[model samples]
Each structure stands twice: as structure tokens, then as C-alpha cells.
Target: MHLDPFELHRPTSVDEAVRLAGELAGRFDFLAGGTDLLPNYKMHINLKPHLVALDRVSELAGHSLSRLGAMERLSRLEQDPAFVAAYPGLADALADLATPLVRASGTVGGNLLLETRCFFFNQSYFWRASLGFCLKADGDRCHVVPQKERCYATFSGDLAPPLLTLGATVEVAGPGGRRKVPLEKLYDTEGDGIRRLRLAPGELVVAVDLPDGAAGQRARYKKLRVRPSFDFPELGVAVAGRWNSAQVDELKVAVGGVETYPRRFDELTEALVGGPLSDAKVASLAEEITRRLRPVHNTFLAPDYRRRMIGIYVRRAILEAREGQGG
Candidate 1:
């Protein structure tokens, strides 16, 4: 498939980019890495009339130990010794994401805001047309769940789970002003896959900020996919916490690629914070996570299998984190 013609605007600064986006409104899409958006465009899914390319925006490319610019390349972060050492779980997720060539061009912001995928939504134009279209693109109803008011497309990103577990925040700029919100808040749990993100019109993600002490936490990311080489995650579980001599001091768990958004188990984490890291506790936590998540038949994997793997992966990730802590 080939890309349909559209005007591309290269904005030099964030202010200029926001202004252009505000003017273009519903007709434009922000181009950072184009690793995800360009392919979707080729499939004729959510095609925009204009494109605001952010490659020339110098401010969006900055990175440090604590703050990572949204436009920072995935491959750059994966290969950087200091970055990898500081955030091993994040580094692992990046390493497991797509192939090296795609990772070299995939941006952190793009991955965080990756589009929800489904068997019906991500298809060639003719293939979708034969099925009368789906809710995400040209049609009005959802084919996956056959719902008139909801879409069941799955969020297939790998970076979000680990970042959420790390308690990262994101800086966003728009016509109103700049503001920072917890990275988990970026997703709209109340909305369907067609309208998943909570970001307003013309808003751009500036940077992702990790708290000062986040790097010191013991963390692990476990992913399950059809192929180990370069496939989108079927199930991803990320766990992070500090251990106090075989006991949990602090804890956070986030799971992705199951539903409309990446979700964190606050209650489970709070309950386990002061408890001992025993096999029984880990098994209970895993069982609760499996009960809470409801993976549908949108991806290549079966719903029941994916749902079961969530518990297994979560259990394995927590144990791995515990082992890393030498507890």
C-alpha cells in the first residue's frame, strides 16, 4: 500500500507546533517517529489531511537520567549504557519492542500513545470495506464485541506498563498551557478504543519525567507474544518495588496489552507493601490480577490463554524483582 498525499508542516518549536495543531484541529496528526502512524495511514485508518512533523523541534529531543524527552529514539535508550543501567525494566521493554530498524525510529511518546489495535480495525482498506468497516476508522459499530456503544480494541504498547510501574509523569503542551500529569492518567479508562487517550485536541507530549529515586527500585518486565523476535506484546506485566530484608517496602504493578488501557493494581500494591515476599503471597497477588483483567479475543492469542498468562507473567515478574533485590 502507498501513502495518500497530505501537507507536511515542519515546526521549529513547541509553541509553533501547538499553534499549527490548533489551527488544523481535527485535520492534522503530529509526526514524531512515524513508525506507527505512517503504517496506520497506509492502511487508510484514521487518515488526516495534514501532518505536523516534530522532528525539527529541538526541545522535544532532550534527555537526562530523570527526564526523557518524548522524541527520544527507542534504540538510543536501549543501547545507552547509563540509561540501560539506570532503568533496566524500561531498557528491557525497549529491547523487546519491534526490530532494531523500527526501534531506531520509534519515539517514546509514540509508544506511550500507541493506538489500540484489533482484528477488525487494523486491516487493508479493501479488507475492512468487505467487512463494512469497524468503529475505530470509518464505521460506526464495533465488530470485535459487536457492541453499539463500545469498542474492544486492545492497547498493544510495551513501554507503558514499565513506565507506569515506575510512577512516571508526562508533560503536555496545548492551546490552554503546559501541565504535568502522572503517566497513567494519560489514558482514558472510561473511553472506548476509538477514543482511548485523555489528551485534548492539539495537545503534544513534551517529556516523560521519572522521579528521582525511581531508578533505585527493583523492577522486572515480563512479556508474552507469539514470536520472541519482533511482535507486539500479547501480554506484558511490569512490577517495581523496594524490598526490606525479604519484605516488601514499596510496590507497584502495571499490566498492558489486555484491554483498552494499561492498568495498575493500586489496591494489590498497597496491600503487599509491608508483607513478606513469600510464594503464597505472590500466588495470591497473581490470582487477584488474573481475576481483575478481562482480555478479549482481539489479538492473535486466545482470550482465555492471554488472561491466564497475565497471572503467570505477573507472578514471574514479581518473583524476578524479588530475586533482583536479593531477598
Candidate 2:
């Protein structure tokens, strides 16, 4: 498969990029890493007439302990000792993302905004035509859930769960202006996979900001996928918190790959806080996660198996965090 013809625009500034996006409107798409977008384009998944490449924008490139520019390559960030030490769980997710070559081309922002995937939607044009297109791309009905109104394509990003657990916020620039929101807010909870992100037209993510205290927290990321070498996550769990002796403090848990968005379990966090990190509590938290998630048959794994693994992965992530804290 090959990429469809499109006009490519290289904008040197954020303002210029926003202007291009605004002018093009629904006919355009932002190009950051192109690791995800280009492949989808090649498969004729979603074809836009204009590509606004952010490569020339200098403002989107840099990284510190607390601030990560969206344009920074995943491979670079994963190999950086200081960055790895600062955000170990995020580094772990990055390392487990794709192969080194794909990571080299994938950026933090791209991963954060990776497209939702489904077995039926991500096929060749002929294959999709043969089966009738799904809601995400050309058709209206969702094959995953066989619903007219909702698309059940699964969220497959590996970075979002860890970043959400770390309390990261993203800076976005658009025609309106710049604003920051919690990383979790970037996703549209009520929207289907066809319209998943909350980003407005002409908006571009500038950077991701992590709290200084986030670096000191104990965290772990557990991922389940069919292939260890490289494949989208079937299920992923990320946990972060401070261990006050044997008790939990200010905990955050985020789950992904089994839902339409990476979700932070505020209810579970509230239940676990100020309590001892015991097996019973962990098991209960995992059970709650399993109860909350409803995985559809969009990925390679079976829905029931993925739902069951949610509890297992959550338990393992929390336990690993506790063990990492030397508890």
C-alpha cells in the first residue's frame, strides 16, 4: 500500500501551523512523527487533502525533567538516563511501545494522540470494501460492536496511561490561544472512536508538563500484547503513588487498550488512599477495574480475556509499584 496524494505544508511556527490548520479545516491533518498517520493513510483509512507537517516548528522540540516537548522522539527519550530516572514508568511504556526503528520515528505527542484501532477498520481498502467499511474510516456502521451510533475501536496508545498516572498536563495552541489541561482531558470520554480526541480544529499540542513531585513517586507500567517484539497493547495498566510506609498516598491508576480512552480510576484511587497496600486491597482495586471496563472484540485478543487480564495487570502493576518502593 502507498500513501495517497496530498499537499504537504511545513510550518515553521505554531501560529503558522494553526493558521494552516484553520484555513484547511476538515481537509487537513497535523503531521508530527508520521509513524501512525502515514501508515493509516497508506492503508487508505482516513485521507486528508493537506498535511501540516510540524517538523520545522522549533518550539515543539526539547525536554527537561518536568517538561517534555511533543516532538521529542520516543527512542531518544527512552534511552536518556536522566529522563528514564525521572519518569521510569513512562520510559518503560516507551521501551515497550514498538520496535526501536518505529520508536525512532514516533514522537511523544504522536503516541499520546495515536489513532484508535480495530481489526476491521485497519485493513486494506479492498479488504474493507469487501467487508463493508467501518465507522472510523469510510463507512458508518461499526463492525466491532455492530452499532449504528458507536464505534468500538480500541485505544492502543502505550504512553497515555503512564502519562495520565503521572498527572501530566498538555499545552495546546490554536487560533483561539494557548491553554493547558490535564493529559487525561485530552481524550473524549463520551465520544466514539471515530471522534475520540477533544482537540478542536486548528489546535496543536505544544508540550507535556509533568509535576515536579511526579518524579519522586513510585510507579509501574504493565502491558499485555500478542507480540513482545512489537504490537499494539491488548491491555495496559499503570499505577503511581507515594508509599507512606506500607500505606498508599495520593495514588493514581490508569488503564488503556481495553477502552475508547485511557482512563484514570479516581474511584479506585480514593478507595486505596491512606490504606495499607495489602493483597486484599489490591485485589479489590483490580476487581473494580475489571468491573468498570468493557472490552469489545476490536483487537487480536478476545474481549473476555482482555477484560480478565485487566484485573491481573492492574494487580501486578500495583504490586510492582509496592515492591519497587521496597515495601
Candidate 3:
């Protein structure tokens, strides 16, 4: 309920932030909007001694049509008519993250790096201690899987799915220096919930680079949560592609909120790219993806129901995006 005291370091540039991170080593956390990190901190989940606040880093702050800075606020993106029109699925994600109040302070990078969550991990300090620890935080074993090897906490962020569908790339800065990587490659597919991202230690996301191929691609994002607002998604599906007449020119589907990390179905989508996609074909694609998912009972929703709805949400998203026009 209360924040334990910690040293806060404000760096005005990315280089300075990375240097500070190296100095602090494993003892620090990069604070963006603090919407995600602070809440976890208050719950006494993985408390660090130092905080590197990135608010003063002006370089990570703006958005043109082609690039979205890491520190750019969700509310700011949601309000831009041009941006929303250009990346409608991303707009849906931004608007659907938490509430307007939270979104006002929720930065893009924070949400992208949002902590994986589970019923056992996100409890009060006393409650967590009383119940014993989980692998995601203080404990060694996972309550959900009842094992010491892997954690089953679900990926609850909304932006990654839509961004993944767009074939976006991220600019990363660290002690090793700067580089860009495909958005899907940013997630560690082989890692479990406790070790989700592929980022190196002391590295931070700089910005999201929207590729030229992403331009004017029709896209849709569908999220299923406990409520229409505030609650984290139980199932989130995103579909993006361009259609030439009734034939699929390019198609990609990425799903989140139901697994350890958001992922794209490139192989499946690839097969349909050059073919004429009918309603039945879309339905089959959705069912196949749903069948492949293995969501556990980690979040509020039951895994069975979430799994069942995956087919429906994916079907709906693809159907809607196919008809919609941006290009």
C-alpha cells in the first residue's frame, strides 16, 4: 500500500541513463511513467534499491507517423487523429490500456516491458508472504505450475500484439550500444514468464520503428477482459494485412494476454498470403491458432474459456480487417 524509500536517478539522456544503469547494476529499475513498476513496487514484488527515471530523457518523447518514441504517453497517441487513422489497431490498444488517468502517465515502453502477472504473484506483501512465494517474484517455485522450473504468469500488455502485426522493430540502447531488432524478436520465445524479454541487462527500449510495409495496412485488435475497461485482457488478438481484391496480399496475426509472451503466426499467415481467403478459410485459420495455444489458469479467466474465445476473437478480427481499408 505504500512505497518503500529508494534512490531516484534522473538522467537527461539515453547515454547517461545507460551509464547509471551499469553503475547501479542489478540494483536499479528504469522508471518510465511508473504506472506498471510503481504498482508492483507497492506490492513488494522485486524491490530494487535504485530507480532510473527516464522522464527527463527528451529524446524518447515524440511520435511522427513512422516512429513512436518509447516514453510517449498512451493517451497522447490515443488522442492523435492522424496516428489513430494510420495505425487503428495500435490506437485500439492504446485506448484500451487501463483507464484514461493511467494512460495519461503510461508510456509506450513501460507497457511493452510490463511485468508478467499471475494470481499468486500480484498480491499484497503480507498475503504473498503468507501464501509463500512464486517464481516471478520472491519465491522459487511456481504456484500455478507447482514446479521450480517455469512460471505460468500471463503476458497482459495490449500494445505488443498490434505492434507485432505491423512488423515493427524496436531501437534498443544499452552498455553494449544501440541496435534495432524486429519486434517479434524482442520477446524471448524460449523463456518462461519469469524470464520473458530478450533484452540484455541495463538495456532499454528507445523507440518503435514502423516499417514502410506497415503503411496503410488494414488492422484490427480485439481484447477480452473481465470488464470493458481497467481490467487486464484475458485474450487479445490482432490481425493486420493488405488485401488485393479478395486475395490476401499480406497477412499477419499476433496474440497476447493469453500466453507467456505475445507471438505472431507467420507460418500460418504466410500460407494464406497469396491465396484468396474466404470466410470459411478465415474460420479455419482462427481455429488452428486457437488449438495451438496452451494458456493455463494463471489469470482471472479460465483457460478453457479463454482458449475457446481465441478462435472467435481471431476470426472476428481477421474478418473485420479484411473488409476495412487503410491502403
Candidate 4:
């Protein structure tokens, strides 16, 4: 696979980037670490005419415990022991994404705004041409679900779940100016999966802000993938909560790699917050989540297997997070 030539635009500031995006409109894609986009480009997936490189954008560079820049590389975050220790669940996700080499070039924004994946969508040009394409690409129908109304491509990103557990929010910039949106609302599952994120036409993610309370929570992330070193997750589960003497104070459970979006079970998790999360309760929670998710046969794992593992992984993540506090 080889990257076809395209016009590369480097913006020194956020304003410049936004201007460039407005000028280019639908003909451009923002280039972060290029770990994911480059590969797709090599396979001649969605070839945009212009590439907006964010490397020189000063507004999208920097990282602290409270805020992580959109352009921050995963390798940089993993190298910081304090950052990793503060959010162990996020650390697990960071490590689990691709491999060391890919992580070296994978940025937080790239991962958060990752493209939806499907078996029929992520193939070479010749393969997709032979199959007549899918809803996410050049065709009118979804190959995964055999439908024309909605795309069933899975949201395979791992960062969103752990970040949602931490109550993270994202800073976005557009022609209308900057605004903040909760990370949980970032992925729009209700809409046609082809649209994916909730961002406007010219908007771009600037950074992700972490809440002060998220720093001390007992958090854990568990991912199921075909290959540990390099492969997208078939299922990723994350749990974060504050425990007090066998009772739950605040709890958030998020799962990705199973559906169109990485979702938080706020209704289910909120119901058990004031009470204790016993083994039986945890098992029920797991079963309910397993029942709710709709995994398609897109990735390496079967829909049934992925659905079954949801209960197991969710239970394990919640239990391990609870055990972390030893109560």
C-alpha cells in the first residue's frame, strides 16, 4: 500500500487551521499522528484532495493532568509515569491501542475521532470495488447489515470509553468559535453511522479536559482483540468509581468496539450508585449490558462471541476496579 499524493497544508495556529478547513471544506481531512489515516489512505479508502496537518498548530499542543492536547501522542502520555498512574484505565487503553511503533505516531485526537470500521469498508480499492462498496464509502447500502438506511460500522476507538468514565469533555474550534462538549456526546449513535461524530462542518477538536474528581477514581479498562500487539478491539470495557466501605458512591461503565458508538450505561450504572455493587448485582449489570449492546459481524470476532464477552469483561472491569480500593 502506498499513499497517493495530496496537497498538504500546515497551519501554525488554531485560527489558521479553521480558516484552512473552511476554505477546503469537504475536500480536506485533518492530519494528526497519521497512524490510522495514512494506512487508510494507502489502501485508497477516502482520498481527500487536501490534508490539513496539525503538527504546527500551537493551540493543539501541550499536556497536563487536567488537559490533554488534541495533538498529544499516545507514546508521550505512556512515557509519563505520573500521568499513567493517575488514570490506570486510560493507561491500559493507551497501551492496548495498536503497538509501540503505531502508538509512537498515534495522537489522542486521532484515536478519539477515529473512523468507524467494518469488514466491508476497510479493504483495498480493488476489494471494495469488487463488492460494490458500502454505506460508509461509495455505496448506498450497508454490507454488514444488508440495509440501505443505516451504516452498521463499529466505533472501534478505545480512548472514548475510559475518558467517558472520567467525565471528560472536549474543546472544539470552528468558524463560529470554540465550545465544549462532553466526551460522552461526541459519538452520535442515533444518526446514520456514516455521519459518526457530532462536530459541525468546519469544527476541529482542540483538547480533552479531565475533571479533578477523575484523578482519584478506581478505574480499569479491559479490551478484547484478536492480537495484543496490533489489532483493533472487538470489545473494550471500562469502569471507574469511588467506593466507600463496600458501597458505591459514583460509578460509570462504558463499552466500545461493540456498536456504532462507545456508550456509557448511565441509566443502569446510576441506579446502583447509592447502594453496594455486590457480585450478584455486578453479574446482573453485566448481563443487562450484554443484552443491550448490538454487535455486528464486522470485526474478527463473531457477534455472539463479542456479545458474550461483554458480560465477562464488564464484570471483570467492575470487580477489578472495586478490588483496587480493597473494600
List candidate 3 stretches off by more than 4 Å: 325-327
RMSD of 3: 1.2
Q: For model 3, which pairs clash? A: none
Candidate 2 at residue 12, lDDT? Answer: 96
Off by over 4 Å in 2: 325-327
lDDT of each: 0.90, 0.88, 0.90, 0.91
Residue pairs that clash (backbone atoms under 3 angstroms), model 2:
none
Q: What is the TM-score of candidate 4?
A: 0.98
Q: Where is the poorest 10-residue window by lDDT in model 1?
A: 318-327
Per-residue CA lDDT of model 2 for 157-271, tens digit only, reads 9999989988899999999999999998999998656788899888999999988788867888889999999999999888888887788787889999998899999866887
Model 1 compared with the native: what TM-score? 0.98
List the candidates ranked by lDDT, beginning with the highest: 4, 3, 1, 2
RMSD over all Cα atoms, model 4: 1.3
Candidate 1 residues 1-327, lDDT tens each?
989999999999999999999999999999989998999999999999999999999999968889989999888888788887878788778878989999999999999999888888778999999999987788877777784569888899999999998899999999999999999899999866678898999999999999988886788888899998999999998888898888889889999999999999998879777878799999999999999999988899999999989889988888988888311
Candidate 2 global TM-score: 0.97
Clashes in each model (backbone N, CA, C under 3 Å)? 0, 0, 0, 0
Tell me the tens digit of each residue's lDDT in model 4 across 48-146: 989999999987887999999999988999899888888889988988988998888888999999998988988998899898887788877877778
**lDDT, model 1, position 43:** 96
